[model samples]
Target: MDTDLLRTFLEVNKTRHFGRAATNLYLTQSAVSFRIRQLEIKLRTPVFTRKRGNLRLTSAGEKFVPYAENILQTWGRARQDVALTDSYQQQLTVGATSLIWEINNTNEWLEQVEAIQPEWALRTESLNRQQIPSALLEKQVDIVLTSEPPKLADLQQVRLTNFVVVLVSNEPEQNMNTIIGLPLVYLDWGTRFAVEHSRIPALQRAPILHSHGCQPALKFLINRGGVGFLPLSIAQPWIDSCKLYFVKNSPIIQNELFMVWLSSNEKYEDISVLIDVFSETQNTC
Candidate 1:
């Protein structure tokens, strides 16, 4: 069985649109369709209903969902086991939204953890904002650092930090109108930020550039000269270096983050150390 075909099926199932799944998987729509057809031929049953522009799972497909997920999980664990080092006694699988990755310096933190706890092997994953919650519920990752916490009762969410997000731009002097009219790179902060942004009349128009994460927005701001909001901890270092400037009178937004783990996890002490690491990392910014 081809794992790629299984992956394509899962992506299509999640999005319910072949084109959108292709975009998410970085494949052409035709390629995704081909993979699905191949999978159907292999399974000898149609998994999806293709009718009147509707994309839906058949009854068999619904049942196969768990099987597909299990196959992927088992394969993943096998790969990890194959690659395990003898020096590491424990493994920590972690994931983070891209914005959280930037704010917390998560990759560097993993390096620090590896240095301090050589007995533990830490793996980090970068996930889309929408994917984090479900991934946490599935125990696909041991811990997730995200902008918003999951609502699942099976997971434990710890409030990690409340940080300021300030509007930043290449220019120093700014007015409300100018800042609004300027080519903007809007980062999707969260629901509360979305509500507040919608109330601002000038922001109703779509931005010149929009990203779900801060890194791409920040990159565009640096290279192409646009205004966008960034964590103060991220923008502060750049501001001090004169690489970026804070927009005067621009709205400052606050975003809260949480670390989510399975409540059933018995490694309370280990999880606590990770939480402390995430909390104390702000001082390094």
Candidate 2:
């Protein structure tokens, strides 16, 4: 079976919409439909029951999920193993959310890996929340760093570090009450931030702006004048330079960073060394 077909099947299962799956795969909708048809022909079973606006997997389709995932993973590992050069003993691929990359100094960590382990080949990918779990399960990534960890039976989740976020404003002299009344730039920190934010009566209203990444929110807050929660590490320089200030008496939110990988990975010992290197770098910083 063609891996493209399996990828298309998984994408369709993920989005539940043929058009959306096509858009994600950069294929035409007709192409997606045709692939599904070909897959059904090969399987001799209709994997999905297609209603006008509702698409659902058949029992057979649900059963096929694990097999498809396993096939892809095995293929990926085989490809990586075959591609290894004499110069490199092992290849490691790491994926993380954009936020984790920024806050955790992921680039520096990667550089450190190169300095210490020149024989190890490294690949880095930017992953979203939806892709993190599947990426690991499929062997598309060897490890994933994320703020919102995935709860999968096949993965091991390790608490890496805690990051501090504080509500900061461009207006230094503004009181917390006054700052809350101004336009708000809401940054999606993670699940914990969401829960704590809901409990705050002052922030109950809709934000003037919302951003997934910290830099845009921080830029907006600095230029446009608003309050937003920013990672202390990134916001420290701005705070010191008088471009931003901590909102007086505001709640401090600390979020956890996690590193996750397949529990059954044959490279558990080697991967643990890389994890230790990361932790040491964080500690020294």
TM-score of 2: 0.68
The alpha-carbon lDDT assigned to residue 78 of candidate 2 equals 71
Question: Who wins the TM-score comparison?
Answer: 1
Per-model tally of clashing residue pairs: 0, 0
Model 2 lDDT, full chain set = 0.83
Residue-by-residue lDDT tens digits, candidate 1, 103-177: 754555567668777788776777777777766765668888776776777777666557778888877776567
Q: Which tens-of-lDDT digit does each residue in 9-38 have in candidate 2?
A: 999999999999999999999999999999
- Model 2, which residues run further than 4 Å from truth? 1-84, 275-285
- The model with the greatest lDDT is 2
